[model samples]
Target: MDSLTQTIYECLFGAEYYEVNPASDDNTKAADVLRALFSANEGGEHLKKSVHDIVGERGWTENLAKAILGGIENALKQGAQMGKTMADASEKAIAEAVGFARDHPYFCALIAVGVLAILMPWVLEALGFAELGPVEGSFAAWWQSTYRGYVTKDSLFAFFQRLGMVWH
Candidate 1:
C-alpha cells in the first residue's frame, strides 16, 4: 500500500517515484505525509499530528476525496495514452521523412538551402563567424534579403548558380 500511495504522490505532485530526496524539505514532508496516511507497517499514529492535521481540515469528506482520486487516476491514464500515441506517430513520421529525403534528393537539397538561407545569419553569429547587427524587418523581407545577400556575394555566386540549375 505504501507503493500505491507513493505512486499516487508521484502522479499528483510530480515527486520522484522512489527516492525521496532528504535534501529537500518539501519532499521529506510529502513523503512523511504519504507514509503517515497509507503505510501498512509503521505509520499514521507514528505522526499523530499529521493525521490529526489532515482529518481536522474542512471538507475532508470521503466522497470528495474519492472524487479527487478518480480525477487524478484518469489524468495519469490520459497522459500515458497521449505519450504513447505521440511516440508511435513520431517514429512513423521520422521513418517516412527519411524515406522521402532519400527518394527526393533534389527536393531535400532545396529545403536545406532554403532553411540555411533563413537560418545561416543567426547560426553564423552564434558560432562567432560574423558579428551581425540586429535585424529590423518583417521575417519574409529578412529572409529574402539574407538569401539574396549571400547568394549574390562573389564568394558564393558559383555555388548559388549550381543550386539555381537544380531549381531550373
Candidate 2:
C-alpha cells in the first residue's frame, strides 16, 4: 500500500513527487486524493497499474478513474514546462560560452595550441622518440614558469606583428 502511494506520487509530480504531502496508512483516502489529483489533468492510464493494485481494497469506481486521467494530463503539461525551462538555461549557457570564445580569439587559439603541444610528446613517443623529455618539460613548464614573460602585452603584440609581417 505504501509502495502504491509512492508510485502514484511519482507519476504525478515527477521530480518533486517526494517533496509533496502524501497520504499515510489510509488506502481509501489515499486513492481518493490521488483520484482528485489525477482528475484535474486526465492521468487515468498513467497510474492505472498502481490504481488496479489497490482497486479491490480502495473501491475505485469508473468515475474516479476518469478524474485521475484528467489529473495526469495536468502533470504532463507541468513536466513539459520544466523541460522547456531546463532547455532554455542550457541554450543560454552555450551562447555565453560561444560569445566569450569569440571575443578572445588569441586566448582561444593559445588554449588549442597548448593542448596540441601537450599531446605532441605522447604522439612523438608513440612514433619512436626515446628521449623527448625536453618537449614534455617545455609544455609542462610553460604556464607555471614563463607564461607571463611570453604572453606580456608587448611580447604578444610583437609575436603577432612578426606573424603579420611573415604573411604579408
Give lDDT per model, in order: 0.46, 0.47
lDDT of 1 by residue, 112-133 (tens): 7557645553442332222233
Worst ten in a row by lDDT for model 2: 126-135
C-alpha TM-score for every candidate? 0.25, 0.27
How well does candidate 2 score on lDDT at residue 109? 75
Q: How close to the true structure is residue 118 of candidate 2, measured as C-alpha lDDT?
A: 59
Instruction: Assess the local accuracy of residue 124 in candidate 1 as a C-alpha lDDT between 0 and 100.
Output: 28
| CA deviation > 4 Å runs, candidate 2 | 1-82, 122-168
Task: Candidate 1: list runs displaced more than 4 Å.
Answer: 1-82, 121-168
How would you encode candidate 2's per-residue C-alpha lDDT over 1-42 as one tens digit per residue? 378757665565343424433443333344455543334333
